[model samples]
Target: MNLNIFRKQNVKTYLGEDIKFSRTLSAFDLIAMGVGAVIGTGIFILPGTVAATTAGPGVSLSFLVAAMICALAGMCYAEFASAIPVAGSAYSYGNIIYGEFTGWLMGWALILEYMLAVATVAAGWSSYFASFIKPFGLSLPKAISGPFDPKNGVYFDLVAVVVVVLIALLLAQGMKSSIKINNFAVILKIAIILIFIFVGLQFIKPSNYKPFLPYHMSGVIKGATTVFFAFLGFDVVSSSAAEVKKPQKNMPLGIIGTLAVAVVLYMGVSIVLTGMVNYTDLNVANPVAFALQYVHQNWVAELLSLGAMVGMATMMLTMIYSSSRLIYAMARDGLLPHHFSKFDKKHNSPQISLFVVTVVIALGSAFFSVNQLTNLVSFGTLFAFTLVSFGILRLRKRTDISNTGFKVPGYPVVPIISGLFCIFMMCQLNKDVFIMAAIWLVIGAIIYLVYGYHHSQLENKNSKAEEA
Candidate 1:
């Protein structure tokens, strides 16, 4: 009943509550899931925004810059995920290495990022849906297409809602089915993107690359932060660490391999895009489709639209998967509740956690703008990455358990530099993002006091009850 009580727990007790997801994933499946979640949105969608607003032809460089920062974070995640082999991505590591209070806030920050991220991807999905619907002379109403908030000039987004519902159904079924679907989705989208790049390459004009950093010095920073969205899916690889057959070896391969593949594809597609058409002419939202149109490959644009629709669906699918697992880790440790953290015995999935995340994502997708949601996703990810980088240093000093696989080669220096890079990117997001982040942290603290603290495992409640 005391409001000012504090409790703490160690890793062993926390791991006891998990439903044993140890047999469901392989290195390939883990990598495929990362590819499935990350591949679609950034390359196919964000290049245009970078091209139009930041770097123009130099958006390719932006992709590389973002990838560099992620490369560091990815390695840190692979190391942590492999050692712990748990479902909670940064949140679990933060708790074990940093402390519970820090971990809770990280978990809370993640809810906004992933929830809005799903909504953002759903909005992107909606645009592609509208594009596909257009050929039949069918167009959805503006109000149905999106909410006219009037404040920002929009309120509801129907297409995003539809996408969220369909994906949630798939996710609620189980991780195995979700992984299988993601494998197919990732392959199909990659094939489609490759088609865009290969065909678009033959038509490159060279002039488009002339004034690359169109926005000047700051453009690189702008493009770097914007393109970070493309690099988003890498963390999902780490989230499934608990399920991997060989967490130590497989986690790194999946995280590193998936990110390497994505960055290459992003750069290739960016080059083909600007080469085929001047970056200035690209639609920030619909660049790839438009680039195909420039080469008289309008039919491919149609296919791109369809691929994109499917791509975003899978991204939302995996993102929701990651979110549920992270939250489940929190809840099983008494941060939320047994209900939110429970797993399905038959399906071997976090059904309750997944369902809660799905509802929040669906509602957000139905209401928010794409631009508004993108910042939300980016803001928290940078902070989480910074924590993971710092966790590497702390975990090393605190635990004598030598990591068996994917160690950060340089120890303190690698993580220190990575943490710095993460900070650099975090500062690049609009100043408003920091304000939103602060408010969320305050709310998380309030919940920790009123709920998580009392329910905590550290109190040895059963022993005390027997004595009473």
Candidate 2:
């Protein structure tokens, strides 16, 4: 093996990657990014569901356990993102350490994660929109609202499709404007949640929390899976690695600080909301609104509903933003069409790439409801994270990648434990989700064997032709 060739390939990053991101983001901005991504359905909807379905009012415990898992994985990612400080987030990390196929696979799985995430947010928005407008007895008909669910009894969701496209158009506009929009959305969402905590505190019934750990050990495990979705948005912080100023120092601070605030918010909301009504009667589909409705606070529910709809819009925006960037990076390396990698110099965004990404999202949302579309957002992310955690441990041993400012505290132990935690949560997923995630992996494998292997940027066609 020629060390010089290997070094040269590493130097190019397989693309004329430019330093476009401003290192101006402080810890606060990164924390805002995490909050924007994490606050969606998980906090607004899932806690009630987790409490009712698994923990029985003891959902606060479930959230704490889930936060522990998130903390472990977040530490590893913070280390990698700071060390690499490049575009593509985990996709770049995997590529630099594991080679082309693994890298592309990570990037590809990320698309699935973000797409499904957007779909879920769309579904959430649709549900909240219907709930909000129902007061005047005006709401979307079942055909548009319920969204074709044999299990939950839905019948086609037009609103969801519309929402996905709307967010896509916003992101296609570019990053500066997108960031401003996201900032506003994040503030609105946090304010709404604070209102719920303050106004709903008086309604708490101590009897509702009788058995805090209602399900005990089994319940805790179930709650972990339910609330794991809340932890989903923290990784969006890493997706901004390409744009961060001093990504090394800022990434970890952002991840830890954001999760800390998010956890406090999650725990507070779960406790107050469940205490307002027995966890048994809380609506899993639209948990927070249902809880507010339970306490006869119809006005609060309506207010939260509007807030939620706007918040979901921001959620879709941020998810699409990071995912589209990953696709652009992957395309530039020839893993996907080169055209998809073209950045709009004026907008400083991958405009063509976003167009294609939005097309896929629009089509998916047009057909699938949040429930039926997929439950594997958590799965793909978990898999990618497992790669990143392990990658940090592997890369740390090689000096070439050690120029990063921030590093994980426990080295082999921290990353190894994080990898284990990822697998644990993955196993907790439903069998159907497990099978579906496996199928996605198989598809990635096939693509790698057929195309990625032949066109591998690692083979260095430019340099190879020179040698020939």
Q: Summarize candidate 2's per-residue lDDT along 1-468 as a digit string, tens digits.
A: 322212222523522363654445567777877888787756777778778888888788788888888888898888877777777888777777776667777877888899888877777777777766776889765555645665655656787778777777877776667777778888888898999999889899999888777788789777877787677878878877777777778888988887898889999999998898888887567788887777788888777877777777877887888878788777766767678888786777788878887877766665575665456887888888888878877778766655547787877898898898888777777898878877887898787667755555554644653454
Candidate 1 per-residue lDDT, tens place, 114-142, comes to 77788777877887788788879998767
lDDT of 1 at 93: 80
Q: Candidate 1 at residue 217, lDDT? A: 64
List TM-scores for all candidates, in order. 0.90, 0.89
List per-candidate RMSD values in Å: 3.5, 3.9
Model 2 TM-score, all chains together: 0.89
Among these predictions, the greatest TM-score belongs to: 1
Q: By how many angstroms RMSD does model 2 differ from the true structure?
A: 3.9
